[model samples]
Target: MRGRNIKKAAYPYILWTALFVIAPMFLVMANAFSAADGSFTTANFARAFEPIYLAVMWRSVELAAVCTAICLLLGYPAAYFIARLRLKSRGALLFLVIVPMWMNFLLRTYAWLTILEKNGVINSALEFLGLPKLNLLYNSGAVVLGMVYNFLPFMILPLYTVLEKTDGTLVEAAQDLGASRAGVFFRVTLPLSLPGVLSGVTMVFMPAVTTFVESNLLGGNHFILIGNLIEQQFLTVYDWRFGSALSVILMLIILISMGAAELAGGAGEET
Candidate 1:
């Protein structure tokens, strides 16, 4: 009776996933392989491999990598510090870290646009200080900044969760054995936190690679990533077939990356 009740409780979520996730994926696959006249064709996939598309794909990967690296470098220390805080302060600090994420992502990106634009906040400040106004908006740097700002919490939260749950006794034991702070961190804390690091990397990298809004708002016309190209194909040009093909390819790449991360995380845990 208990098992049946558990299954009944899960049914709603199972149905939701099927309708929203699995059904859309199937629809994408159908669009990817079908012609406008409804006949099966491979042209969409073929077109996805063109040199222009390949370049955009490379750029997307590069940008996402940079963003992920930056997030790791910035988020790890912040999360660790927060995790080590007193319980009351830790809750407040982590809450602050996550609060920005509750706002609409598009609105946040637009806010960055206002801050980064010429004659905007940063530029106006520079003008007041008699410094040259920085060309912050409409470039790769701006896009990366937008991504980092938007996705930072995703990286921090997982790390904080893992770090907070880490057994405190291990650190004490390491210290009792005469291990220095740095040694304790590197030899004990870091090794134990690998799972969280991997989770954070996966969370940050996936969205960074697939984001179109950040690139669109911050990169302007000067820069283009694969996401932008895919968006243009579907919304601007009304080419759903090619867009679906691009989506499938990107989804496959992400799935492969996630699989690799899971394997690496498993190996770390085993060791």
Candidate 2:
């Protein structure tokens, strides 16, 4: 009976690990390691380090990092507000934070396209206000905005979880000990919330860097992220070998980011 229960408990995790993580990763490695001669080769990865791909890759890292910073700056305030709320209103505020996530992601990007385009609602509104018309669409700024907008909830929710459950007595004790507000936040609240911040940062940055639709639609395909490069290699260029290599490289970047998050989390926990 105990054995059967143990198996049942482990079943879902095993299935998810295999289906979502293992299988897809194996496919990527297989494609990346195999060559055009149908033989094993590291040449595919060698191709990935070429200047053009590296440039796009660096751009992706920069973009994701910038978006992550924006999310943290904007989300931290909302989370702090929600954390300070009375219990009755907390649920409502959280609901508002998460509701947008229920809408289709692509649909949200499309909405941005309409609002930001030349002579669109914003431009018209500016014209009506007798302001200079701004052509804001189809640029890197719009892409960053879309990514930050889409992923903001992810940034907020984790931090909210950590901050909401924090020990109030510790905070009070710090205040009683004469720690200033900023000192308390930097020393107590911020450190205490590091787990959630790490989670939120990881949740925002990794996917933000890899988004294809936002850059394609809102960015006007003028800026090509690593995700966009991979898409081109597969769909437009029809070069699965190079695409697989790019995929492998992209995975490495995410892995590195996640590893750094984990290390930071561990260090914070140790403190």
Error of 1 at 16 (Å): 1.7
Instruction: For candidate 2, write residues 1-271 as lDDT tens digits.
Output: 9999999999999999999999988988888899887799999888888898788899899889999999999999899889999998999999999898889999988888889988789999999999999979878899899999999999999999999998999899999999999989988999999989999999999899788888899987677888998999889998888898899888889999899889978998896
Best by TM-score: 1
lDDT of 1 by residue, 1-271 (tens): 9999999999999999999999999999999999989999999999999998888988998999899999999999999999999999999999899899789999999999999999899999999999999999999999999999999999999999999988989999999999999999998999899989999999999999999999999999758888898889888999999999999999987888789888988897786
Residue 114's lDDT within candidate 1 is 95
lDDT of 1: 0.93
- Candidate 2 local distance difference test against the native: 0.91
Root mean square deviation (Cα) for candidate 1: 1.4
Position 265, candidate 2: lDDT: 88
